[model samples]
Target: MFRLALKSLLNRRGTVLLTVFTIALSTALLVGVERVRSEARSSFASTLSGTDLIVGARAGTVQLLLYSVFRLGEPTANVSWATYQQIAAAPAVAWTVPISLGDSHRGYRVLGTTGAYFEHYRFGNRQPLAFAHGEPFAGVYEAVLGSEVAAKLGYSLGDDIVIAHGIGRVSFSNHDDKPFRIAGILAPTGTPVDRTVHVPLAAIEAIHLDWQSGTRLPGRGISAEQALTHDLTPRSITAFLVGLKSRVATFQLQRQINEYRGEALSAILPGVALQQLWSLTGVAENALRLVAACVVIVGILGMSTALLTTLNERRREMAILRSVGARPRTILGLLCLEAMSLTLAGIVLGVLLLYAILAAVRGYAASQFGLFLGLGLPTAAELYALAAIFSAGLVAGMVPAWLGYRRSLSDGLAVRT
Candidate 1:
């Protein structure tokens, strides 16, 4: 029966092949959406691990997280340097790394922070940042490049690079006088850290010394040497990352920071804030999944239509088989087997295509979008989706199977046109 089914499909290879390709495309779309969505969530969740609280000027927690951690947007307001110091001085606080934004180097964000950032910042299962080349920035005139920044710009240790005044890629107000030499190159962490340029907090201050209101002061230039002789203390920073002495003090310190009398502030637990961000994005994710599912349905319907059309052309073949002692049920089973074979072949082809595309674009996706896709075995959710698709295909085949049974009985002992 299986041999007969195989030959039957081979008889109409052209249509069968097209049907398989359509189904393959749909299967790929469905599985690909799930894979990318799952990996994106994992990447975001692991970006800021081991941090207890993120303190910043009063704003939405999600907004603060996106700007401070992911570098997606700008801060609504700056937190005073004094406020950051007070938060760091809290009895329950173990360490704090102040983040000063508002600078860019060739489209990548330049993050001005202290050495404590390398010592305390964690990601991806409490993993500490590691250097692939030199050491962390220790001097105000030096900088450390993230893996992506170094590779994309072809920068090496000791290469001098000028930072721009604002976050835009093209800035007319470039800090040309005080260019920073590359001090270190960090190893890739598959997080946003891989895209940042790290510099000492004082570097941020030194570059802005001769600027006012986001522009260089007219005819009043502070040379790099002269700027160093003056106070380089930062007046304000974008935000700060805080680690607690104990897990128990997290909530207490968070409450204290939120209610501080000196300034309007907000402290958020990193895990909670990350969850909120994911929930907010859930709507769009679901919509994508729905679209993929609809395409799969359309593909299945196309396969069904192909099968129904083939029944008319094969009526004479059905009559010959019945004359050769084939039962109605046997004819029905043969048609069903052909359907299953086509679906199974499509699934295999789709899976192979998916892995091929993943291998080709994995590195580009990580570099361009910070999305890391791995070529591992399908997750349980993916397996379930495949199984459900196979079941639906089987059910769809039953309709043609029933019609073939009735047609075999009616057309027996006579060759139909």
Candidate 2:
């Protein structure tokens, strides 16, 4: 039966190839989307699991996460260093890292914090920032660039760059006189950290010391040397990344921190905020999945339509099989086998195509977007899609198979489709 089916399909290679190609492209779409969804989900969960609470000015949970973790927006009001100190001094607080963000070099955000940031701030399940170049920056005028910033700005160890105040489309003030030398370059962390520049919190104050209202002290120029001697108090910090002393105290800490009287501040669990984000995005995700399923259905329908339409032309062929004492069931099996074979071929083609695309853009995607797709054999999602396709093919073929069987039954040697 299998040999007969193969020979029948081989004789109709042109039409069979088209049907298989259709199924293959649909399978690829289904598999590719699933891969992105899986990897993106894994990336989001692993990125911020270590932080117990992210403290910032009173804002929506998503807003706070956007500003603090992804650097998508600025805090409306910064928590004063005094407030940060109070939080750090709390018995419930295991450790704290102050973050002061405002400046930018080109497009990458510059973070002002202490060495404690590098020590405690984690990504992907408490994964520490690994260095690719020198150690952490110690001097006020030294900077550590993230992998993305280094690659984008063509910066390396010992390179100096000016900081610009305010993350605007354009800025008039530049800290050119007090340029910072790159002390280290961090390895690719696959998070927002990969695109940030890190310097001591004091450096943030140092650069803005001689300036007022986002410009140099006009008619009162203070040299970088003279500016160093003067008091540079940072009025506020963008936010602080906090870790709790005990895992059980998360709720207590969140409630305590949100009700703090010092400022309109709030603390949110990174994981919870991410869940909220996914919940919001779930509608669109489902819509996309539905569309993909429809595409697969259309492809299967196309295969069924092609086979059914050709029944009249192949009616003579069916008659010959019946004359050779091939049962009506044999003819049905042959038709069903063709559809299943087409679906399987399509699965193989689509997978091979995806691998080719991944190979072509592996470096570009990683360097430009920091998205690293791990190439391997079929994931469970791909396997599931393949199974679904084959099943759909079988169901689709059954209709035409039944039609062919009936025609063969009615006209054993004189067929009419």
Candidate 3:
């Protein structure tokens, strides 16, 4: 039966091939979307794996995560440097790394942080930050470039780069006088960190010393040397990441920060905040899955349509098999085998194509889009999705197979023009 089905499909290779290609494309779409969706969530979850709580001015948890960790938006307010220090001094707090934003260098965000950032910040299974070249910023006038920033801007250690006053790419008020020398370049982290420029928190204060209202004060010149002599301590910071001495005290510390009397503050568990983000994004993810599923259905239906259309043309063939004492059930099984074979072939091709495309674009996706796609075996979820597609194909083919079984040998062998 399998051999006969194979020969029959070979005889109509044109239509069969087209049907297989259609199914292959849809299967690829379904599995590809699933892979990207899963990877994106994994990436987002791992973006701050080592951090316990992210503390910032009172705002929505997701909003705080967006601006603090992802650099997606502006902070609602800043935490006083005094408040940050107080929190750092908490007994339960093991360490805290303050982050000050509101500056940019040529479209990339400038992150004002301390050397502890490199030591504490982590991604992808508690991986520590490593330097691709040079070391962390040491001096007030020095800067560290993320891997992406260095590569994209063609900057290296000892190169002087000016910091802009605001987040805009084109700033009318530039701190050209106090340009920073590149002190370090961090390895690619495949997170928002890659797109950031790291500098001491004091660098943020030093650049804004001669500026007011988001512009450089005219006729008021403070040379880099002169600015260094003056106070460069930051008055406030956008947010801070906190690590606890004991995991059991996380909730206690979070509650304390939320109820602090000096100012309104919010502290969130990074894991919980990430789950909130997933909840918000789940709708769109499901919509994409639904669309992929619809495409798969269309492909399966097209295959069934093709099979039904060919039943008429193969009537004489069916009659010949029936005359040879082949049971109607045998004819049905042949059609069913053909459908399963086509589906299996399509699935194999689609998986191969998916991995091929992923291998070719994996680096590009990581560097350009911050999307990390592993070129590993298909995940269990992906395997399940493929199995579901194959099963649907089997059920779809049964429609045509049933109709073929219902056909009488006399009806097929009847004389027709």
Candidate 4:
């Protein structure tokens, strides 16, 4: 029966191939979308590492994180400098690195932070930032560029670049035109750090001495050199990354931040806050999966349609098999085998195609999106999804096979009327 099934399917290879390719495309899309989502979640989660808490003004925690770490959104309000000093001086705080955002050189974000950032901040599970060239920013105007910033802009040590006032694509305000001397360039970290340009908080204040909000002073202006003599004290910063001296002090500090008497500020554990943010965005994630699954389903439907249409052409073939003393069960097995075979072929082809795609794109995705997609073994969930697809294909084939078998019996020993 199996031999006959193989011979029969081979004879119908033209139609079978079309069906297989159809199912293959569907399976690949379903698997690919799901894998992308899972990996992206992991990538986003990796953005927050080793930091116990993030303290910022009383706005959305998600917004605070986006501006503080990801540089995607505007800060609702800046936390007071005095408040940050208090938070840093808290008994529970081990080290605090203040971040002043909303400036960018060309396209990369400018992070005005202290040297403690290079020492205490961590990414991707406590990995430290390493210098690719030169040292950390030592003076107010010295800058450290992330790997992306350096590579994209072709920046190197001792290079000078001017920053713009706002974070977006278009901003009218320019910094006091004092170019920042590139003190260092960092090795690629694959986190948001790889896209940032770091400078001292004093430099941030210095750039905006004559600016208000996001605009330049209009009539009041100072050359980058003239601004040097002025006291560039930062009135506020976007947020502060906090590491606790003891694990026990986390709850205490969160309580302190939430109940602070002077200012409306809040503190959040990075991991917990990330979890909450993901939950809020989970709907869109699942919708992506569903949309991919639907696309694959359409392909499977194409496979079914191809098989059903070809049944008419295979009528004589089935009649010949019955005449040759093949049992009804044998005929049924033949149809099922053909369906299963097509599905297997589709699956194998799709896997190869997916591999080729990933190989072609691994470097680009890593460089552009900071997402590292490994072509290693598929996760267990992925395997399950694949298995489900395989089984579904087999079943889809079985339906047409059964119909052919019935037609064979109903018209045994003769062509249909």
Give the worst 10-residue stretch by lDDT in candidate 3. 367-376
**Candidate 3 residue runs with Cα over 4 Å from true position:** none
Better of 1 and 3 by TM-score: 1
Write candidate 1's Cα lDDT for 1-417 as tens digits: 989999989989999999899888888888999999999999998898889999999999999999999999889899999888877998888899899888998889999999999999999999999999999887889999999999999999999999998888788889999999999999999999999999999989999998999999999999999999999999999999998899998888889889999999999998899889889999999999999999888878888889999887788788888888898999889988988998888888888888889999999999888999989999998888788778778778888888889884456556445
Pitting candidate 2 against candidate 3, the one with the higher lDDT is 3
lDDT of 2 by residue, 1-417 (tens): 878888888888999899888887887777777776766677667666578899999999988988888878778788888888888898888888889998988867889989988899788867898899998998888999999889877888999988888886467767887889899999988877888889888889888877788878877766667767866666789898888889898898899989998788989999889989888888887787888889989999999998998877788789888887888888888898887887788888988887887788766776655566668787887788878888988999899999998884346455344
Q: List the residue pairs that clash in candidate 1.
A: none
Candidate 3, 73-190: lDDT as tens digits = 8999999999999999999999889999999999899999998899999898999999999998889989999888999899988999998888987887778999999999999888
TM-score per candidate, chains pooled: 0.98, 0.93, 0.97, 0.93
Q: What is the lDDT of candidate 3?
A: 0.92
TM-score preference between candidates 3 and 4, better one = 3
lDDT of each: 0.90, 0.83, 0.92, 0.82
lDDT of 1: 0.90
Candidate 3, 152: how far from true, in Å? 2.0
Give the per-residue Cα lDDT of candidate 2 at 273: 94
Tell me which of candidates 1 and 2 scores higher on TM-score: 1
lDDT of 4 by residue, 90-150 (tens): 7778899999988887767889999999999788877888998999998889999999889
Pick out the ten consecutive residues of candidate 1 with the lowest summed lDDT: 408-417
| Per-model RMSD to reference | 1.2, 2.2, 1.4, 2.1
